[model samples]
Every structure is written in structure tokens, then in C-alpha cells.
Target: MSRIHSTHDDESIGSDSFLDVVSNIVGILIILVMVAGSRAKSYVREPGEAKSNIATAMDAEAAKADLRATRRTAQSLAGELDMLTREASTLANEVKAAEYARIQLGTFVATTEHELKKQRDELDDKTKRQHDLAARMVAARRKLDDLQREQISVVSTAAPEIVVKSYPSPISATVFTTEVHYRLLNKRLARVPFEELKDLLLDERRQLVWKLEDLPEVSGSVGPRDGFRLDYHFVRTVRGGSLTAAYYIPVESNLGEPFAEALAEGSQFRRAIERLDRQNTTITVWTYPDSFDEFRQLRKELYRLGFSVAGRPLDKDSRIGFSPGGSKSAAQ
Candidate 1:
């Protein structure tokens, strides 16, 4: 029994040992397989990690580039805004200057127009008064001529009646050569205030005396026995009732009856009247047509009333006073 038991123990021990060896071998093989698999997995994981790193780098680079472009665009926009502000300021200044100039010009035009209107009114008023004075002068002159022709005997007979020694017609001084000239001097010079014109006519008396003696008749109505000579003048009435006088003549006789007096005195008186008629025309004015026309019309009336005229009635180039005359019948 001991021997069988001992054998059994040995066998058991041996079998156990053999099973341990096989187990060891299998464990080794398993360890080796696990290492290989782990190596393969590591390789695949390393490649994927490299790819992810590359993608992250590319994305970062694109973001940096976009940031740089945005910064540049912001700078460009700021520059454009500055330029626009400067242009707007310049335009604003120009508009202000133009507005100021327009206001100044408008004021000047208004002032000038006002002055023009005032001047026109003054001119019209002056012209009307001048026309009336001329008319009175023409009437007085006509009466003087009539007196001389109708009253030759009275002038001759009266000793100190201021008889004209001789007077000529077609004269620059017209009628009233010597004695008549003196009488007129007493009458007109007393009332006349224009000393310059009065003096000039009176001073030219020597020339008038010479002209009287030189003419064909050259006699006075009431004085020395030479036949009466005639001087010519043009006379007319104007629109403002003024008289106009000139020194040209285009006369024609319309008388059908013979003269009442064949005496030298009568002839002189008649000749003096002829001269008076001719001298009543020539007049002039420097104004508008309305004013000038008024002067012209009055002169025409004087001529029709036996006032003589020689030249053109009135000129558009003349100046006459705007004041009222001394005569009661004068235009005011």
C-alpha cells in the first residue's frame, strides 16, 4: 500500500509540472500578440494626429490673412471721409460769397432807378413854364411892329418921339435900328435881367446901323428920309404857348391894296414891319419831344397873327428857364 501511494504521489507531481509548462507557453504567445496589435494601432493614430495638426495650422493662417485685409480697408475708408469733408467746406464758402455779391448789386440798381425818375419830373415842369414866356415876348414884338407901320406920321411929327434915323430889314438886329433901338433899350433893358444877352445886342448897334444904311431902302418910319429897309426873321408859337424867333426869311406879299403913305417915313415904317415879321421865328430847346413841341406850337400862333418869321421855328437843342414870367398873360 505504501509503495502504490508513493508512486501515485510522484505521478501526480509530474503531471502538475507538465501542465504548468504548457500554461507558461500559452501566456508568452498571448503577450506577443498583444504587443503587435498595440504597435499597429499606434501607427494609425500617429498619422491621424499629424493630419489634424496640419488642418489647424491652415485655419489659423487664413484667419490672420483676413484680419490684415480688414485693417487695410478701414484705413482706406478713413482717408476718403477726410477728403469729402474738405470738399464740402470749400463749396460752403463759395456759396456764401456769391450770396453777398447778389445783395449789393440789387441795392445799387434800385437807387439809380429812383434818381432817374426824379430828374424826369423836374425836366417836364421846367419846359412848360419856358413855353409860356416865349409867347408873351412874341405878342409884344408884334404890337410894336404894328405901331410903327400905322403911326409913321405921329412918330415923324413928334419932336422927341425917339424917331429911328434909319433901320434895316433882313438885319441880324432886325427892326429898330437907331432911334427905335434906343426906345426898345429903354423898354426892354429896364425890365430885362439877363444883362449878358442884353449887353451883347446893344453892343452890336454899330453893326446894325451900318446894315441899315447899306440896304436898298434903309430909312426910318418917323426919322431921316431914306426909304425903310427890311430885315428878316422867323417867328412861331409853340405848344407851351412860347414864341420862337429866327433869322431866315421866305416871304411873299399877299396885300391887294396900295400903301396909304408914299412918304419916305411911311415907307420906312412899312419896311420896319416887314423886318419884324421875319425876325419872330428861330427858337430851340434841348429836351424831350413833348416839351419841344409845346414851344413850337406857340411860335406858330404868333406868326399867324402877323408876327414875322425868318428861319426855322424851333430847334430841339435849346434851354429855357422853367420859371413863371413877369407878364400877367404869361404861362405859369
Candidate 2:
């Protein structure tokens, strides 16, 4: 029995050792599989890391190129900005110059206007002075004319001495009596221009008294006119002797004569009257001092010299002898 049991136990021990060997093989196979899975995972991770590194290098190159381009553009922009600044400064200088010129021009214009105004005022004053001087000259001329008229008052606007009468036969008196006639006159604003005439002018048809019968008779009338005509006839009369009678007014004046000649003319007149010369009408001009006593002296001298006409009588018994025979002789 012991031998049989030993052989059986040997068999069992072989079997147990075989089983233990199988278990150890299975554990080794599990460990190898896990190691293989971990190796494969590491291989995949290494490939991803190499690819990532390559992509990062390419990105760095592109960034460097972009930075260079940005720097170039910045330099160009900075240069353009400097040019703009220079132009702006130049324009500012021009504006300042223009403003200064405008100020000077305004000042000149204002000063010129002021000078023109002053000149105008002076011109106006001169013109006014000239006008006033002209007016004064005109007034002075008018005054001189008036004085001249007063000196020759009797020569102009003289009343006519026309005789209206009838002869023995009234029809004969209708004929004209005088031949030579003249008129001198002028227009006046205030008083009659009695002194405006300078010289006596005769009509064309009546130059000589002998032309009486042939003289034309003036019939028309005008204002303030003195005119005359004449007629002559040769007829028989009953009277054996002829009588001469004439009427006239004689006035003498030294108004227009020079002072030196006036005295000589007065002396000649006195001599002629003393000798009873051929003149029928006579008047003496008396010169006296400009005083009241001179008027009396002139009257006394006139009476002493047989001349008796005065503007007014200053003494009694004074008389004027105009005609040799007439009412004048009777009154004296």
C-alpha cells in the first residue's frame, strides 16, 4: 500500500507543478500586452509634437516679414507728415503778410479821404470869395452909372418944347415950323435916364434949317419922345418992316469941361457980354467956394457984373434980365 500511495502522490505533484507553470505564463502574457499598448501611445504622441514644432517655426518667419513691411509704411507716413507741416507753416506766413498789407492799405485810404475833404473845403471857400468879388464889382459899376446920369440930367428925357398955336389964318399955323431935330435917351430902372445920352443925334432928313419946307413930318408918337418938323413959305405981307422975335432958354455948365479950361471959358464969356457981341442969349457960370457964405458972395458978384440969374435969390432988389423987351423988362 505504501508503494502504491507513493506513485499516486508523485503523479499529483507533477500535475500541480504543471498548473503553476501555466499560471505564470498567463501573468507574463498580460504584462506584455499592457507594455505594447503603452509603447504605441508614445509613438503617436512623438509624431504630434514634431509636427507642432515645424508649424511654430513657419509662423515665426511670417511674423518677421510682416514687422518689416509695417516699419517701411511708418517711415513713409512720418515723411509725409513733415512735408504737410512745412506747407502749413508757409501758408501761415502768407496769411500774416496779407493781414499786415490790408491794415496799411486801410490806413492809406482813410488818410487820402481826409486830405480830399480838406481840399474841397478850401476850393469851396475860394469859389465863394470870387462870387462875392464879382457881385461887388457889378454894384460899383451901377453906382458909377448913376453918378454919370446925375451929372447930365438935363440932356436926357428932356421935355419937348412943341408950340401949339394959330396964326392970323389958323390954317397956316397947322404947318411945321422947325427943321433940324435930334433926340438922345436911354432906359433906366428907377429914375428917368435923363443923363444916359452921350451926344445929340440928328435925323437923316433934317440936317439943315434951310430944308424946312422939304423936311418930312413925323406923325407917329412914342413914349417920352421929343421930335419936330418944319415948313417954309414965301408970301406977301402988309407990314412994311419985319420984326425979329425968338424965344430960348440958355443954360451954361462946366460939368463936362476940364477944370483948367472952365475958368478960361468963363472969362471969355464975360468979355463977350461986356461988348454986346453977336450972341442974343447968354448965361454966366459962377464959381464959388463950397460954403454958405460963398452962395451970398456969388449972388453979390453976379449983380455987380450985370448978371442976375440964380437958383435962389439971397437978397432983395435982385433981378434977372432975360429979354430986351417983354414982361421981364416991365417987372424989373
The 0-to-1 C-alpha lDDT of every candidate, in the order given, reads 0.39, 0.39
Per-residue accuracy of model 1 over 1-332 as CA lDDT, tens digit each: 34444655565566566556555655654564555456545544554575776545554555456555544544554465455456545644654555455556557667887888888888888887788788888999999998887699676775765754332233433322211110011011111122233344344443445554444323211111121112222122232122122111112222111222311244533444445433333212122333334334433443444443222222344322112222111110
Candidate 1 has an lDDT of 0.39
Q: Over all chains combined, what TM-score does candidate 2 have?
A: 0.32
TM-scores for the candidates: 0.26, 0.32
- Span of 10 residues, lowest total lDDT, candidate 2: 181-190
Candidate number achieving the greatest TM-score relative to the actual structure = 2
* Model 2 spans > 4 angstroms off: 1-58, 148-154, 157-332
Model 1 spans > 4 angstroms off: 1-70, 143-332
What digit string (tens of lDDT, one per residue) describes model 2 on residues 105-189? 6677779989999999999999999999999999999999999998678667777899863212112112122111111111100
